[model samples]
Target: MGRKQSFTATELLDTTKRLVLEHGYDGFHLKLLSEHLPGARSTIYQYYSNKEEIVAACMKHVIVTVLEQASAVDETDAMSALQQLLLIYVGESQLHQLLGDAYKINTANSPAAANDLEFVEQAHLTLKSQLTRLFERAQQDKKLRNDIPLPVLVGVFFNLINTPNMLNIPTPQWSELLFQMWIGGARS
Candidate 1:
């Protein structure tokens, strides 16, 4: 009989990210993940075929989690929706790191790498579509500037999450100032 399941897919993915950060994708393996997680190597194999499959799964998890959180915001308030999504990105620094890793590894000429890129690209499209919809709504209500194209406005909204943190400013103050600057500039 198979061993009882001891870890969840989320737990496995979380461990995978940590291990990837520590050892990098080339150096990671299911054995390492198994040791860090509460399961045997076979248990990990039950869910994934190999390192690439697991990595792809992990990236997909990040994409889905972010999209779900972003989608939960009230659509009636475009600014609030954008701000909430940005706030989530600000809070989850690790998500960007994982995405960076995915981008770095995606150039490899392998099916797994292609799959990884597919997940990242899908995430990008999903975010763009969601933000574009919100921006359109805001524009129809005359809450946003009419001069900028809808795609550009959507790009600006998503760009808010990439605000640099080199100065080590606290997030609350950082987000507040960022939002103020965005609203001040983008408002009609």
Candidate 2:
């Protein structure tokens, strides 16, 4: 009989996400990942053949989670939905940075990697569509300013995920604080 696996795929991907966020795609390697995992280095091969495949899968996993949370949001109240979506984005703030390196992945040799990257691209479009819909609805309701273009508003909203949490506040409170700052602005 085959030996049982020591770690789950989720565990591997979780480590991959953290490492990629810390060292970036160029610096991440199987050897580094194995050191952090519970099994031998060869055990990784049973899951993924190459770094490109692993990273691509990791990126797909992150987006899939965000997409699920974003999709569940109630759009009946556009402003409320926007706030909830902002919280989701803040919770996965590292996603944007991780995806920024997607282009660096050479997927030619690995069909699995190519497929995952394709899914990532589609998920991105879906997320964008959802955000655009919410923004447009909020604008129609006059909850947002008419002076600024919708695209600019959306851009700034997305950029909030990158704001440094210097105080190291917990995710939920930090998300709420950021959402408030986004809506209320920096003015006293």
Best by TM-score: 2
Among these predicted structures, which one has the highest lDDT? 2
lDDT of 2 by residue, 52-137 (tens): 99999999999999999999999999999999999999999999899999999998899999999999999999999999999999
Each prediction's whole-model lDDT (CA): 0.75, 0.93
Query: Lowest-lDDT window of 10 residues in candidate 2?
Result: 1-10
lDDT of 1 by residue, 1-188 (tens): 77665888888988898898788777877788888876467888777777777887787777788878876888778777767766776666567667666745544545765776697788868877887787788888898888988877666655776778767889867776777777797566
Q: Which runs of model 2 end up more than 4 angstroms from their true locations?
A: 1-5
TM of each candidate vs. truth: 0.70, 0.95
